[model samples]
Target: MRELELKYGCNPNQKPARIYMDEGELPITVLNGKPGYINFMDALNSWQLVKALKKATGLPAAASFKHVSPAGAALGTPLTEVEKQIYFADGFDTSPIACAYIKARGADRLCSYGDWAALSDVCDEATARFLAMEVSDGIIAPGYTDEALAILKTKKKGNYNVVQIDPNYEPAPIETRHIYGITFQQGYNNFEINESLLDNIVTENKELPEAARHDLLLALLTLKYTQSNSVCYVKNGQTIGVGAGQQSRIHCTRLAGSKADNWMLRQHPKVLGLQFVDNIRRPNRDNAIDVYISDEYEDVLAEGVWQETFKVKPEPLTREEKKAWIAQMHGVSVGSDAFFPFGDNVERARKSGVEYIAQPGGSIRDDNVIETCNKYGIVMAFTGMRLFHH
Candidate 1:
């Protein structure tokens, strides 16, 4: 098709929206519902992210996108028993593509409430089954298996958006856009991220094992597609935390670090043992868990929100217990969209168990930043490339 119409633009009042190709026919086909302007924006950006991740790691990849940023991204990796439980993958040791989807969805469930999903490879029945259960807007991929297509057709009462893009399609080197009756042009930011970028170790501890390198690469790839003033924390082939569109670098660091810490805190013994009512919904459980992890639980519990979700009222997770559990978290990798002008970012990242970092090293206080990493025995690299996406 040459063009596709939309219900509206980004908002309800922004009327008369459509997407068309300026050169030739559009390369995307919608197999299901009509997608809006923001849906297309998220679909296209997330498609590029998973495509690059698959090429870099040679593994199937997936991303869960909300707004224009990714809530989470992951490569094909087997899920442990604990992971299966937390990701609602019980009783299904699904395919590799399915595993990737679960990890992507589990990154930050709260943010992915109505997300657009992207896959590196073809969608299969295993993956489709997982997606069918979530609260999502649509999905985009290269292709879909017959069984998967049949299953996805049942979601949202057959109105869910399903898109298929040309996997080999490439855009022009120079891109253009118009804003407020003015034209703007720039070269595409297609700089490749690979092992070579991880070669420049700038910390006292120069050891970056293969697994750490994979995590660093994953973080960088995620940051490349994220909004500017972003930071990502990745571990075990998946993104644990992503802070996007913040105005300050320190705020980004702290936001991502706190999410990373919460990811680990969920695995703590006290958290794992929390019992819910026999028929508590997944979304409700997710909300309860978030409140239970945060320090505000003492106040929330007093407000009587806990009694509705749990079988028996559970004690709040204490600050001491949370701190002790967080201390045990290590081997996490963090990536920044631009330079860290101060060592305070490193100090906060250390509190969340960050042991490896990747950021453009252009700050005037680079020495102090390196010194902070040295104090924590962290390994850091200067990629010399800034990834600032709008």
Candidate 2:
């Protein structure tokens, strides 16, 4: 089929929606539910992200997307015991693709609620079982095993969106879109992120360790698909935080840094030991955990609202305790879609244990940025390639 009609556009009132290819048959086959415009948007963008991640790392990759930006992305890496607990995958028989998706969704559980999932590898029974437990709108992958397809077909009362795309399909070099009756076109962004981009070290601390290089590459590759004015914080093989579509660069850094802090705080011993009522759902637990880690925990306690979420009156994670815990966070890597105009971005990033940075490096305040990185013994690289996605 060359075109597929939709129930509606982004909004319900925006009628007469559909997707089509002018030159040839559409590359995707909808094997399950009918996906709306926004669902397809999320699916296609997220598919590109996972494909790039798998190509760069030579591992199964996955992404959770919302509003056309990735809430989380990850490569298939063995999950530690702690990771399994935090991701709520403790007893599941997780395959590599399952682990990748779990890590991606766990990066920011709050943001990934009702997200669209994408996978670089074909979906298998293990992956489908994991996806069945989550609150998601749809999924896109190259293919799915029979058992996997059967399992996914049962989700959302047989209305879950399952899409299969041809792995060999490639779009034209030039891409075009229309907004408000006007047309816009641009050459596709095909910049490959790899170790070569990390060579231009300008900070006093020029140590880009092998692990840091991998994380830097992960961050940069994520930024390549992220909306403009974006910053991503990554560690190990997954993104911990992503701040996208901000008007100010410093805000992006601060937003992403705070998210990174939250990810770290979740692993705190106090957070790990929190007791909840027997039947609280995962989403509620995530929200309660967020409140527990924030400064408002005392307020929650004072308001007598902790009883609804926790089994006992939990001790507030005091600001001092949070600070002490956060201080131990290290080896984080961060990437920016554009140049930093000031040093404040770096300053904010340092608070979240960011030790390595990558950016396009064309700002007039490059000296100040480097100075701030040096102050914290942080290593930075100027990849000289800006990644601005719409």
What CA root-mean-square deviation does each model show from the true structure?
1.0, 1.0
Q: What is the lDDT of candidate 2?
A: 0.93
- Residue pairs clashing in model 1 are none
Q: What is the overall TM-score of model 2 with all chains considered together?
A: 0.98
The CA lDDT of each predicted structure is 0.92, 0.93
Q: What digit string (tens of lDDT, one per residue) describes model 1 on residues 88-159?
A: 789874888889889998988888888999999999999998899888999999999999899888999998
Q: Residue 195 deviation, candidate 2, in Å? A: 1.8
Which ten contiguous residues of candidate 2 have the minimum total lDDT? 186-195
lDDT of 2 at 343: 95
**Highest lDDT among the candidates is held by which one?**
2
Q: What lDDT score is found at residue 316 in candidate 2? A: 83
Residue 212, candidate 1: C-alpha displacement in angstroms: 0.6
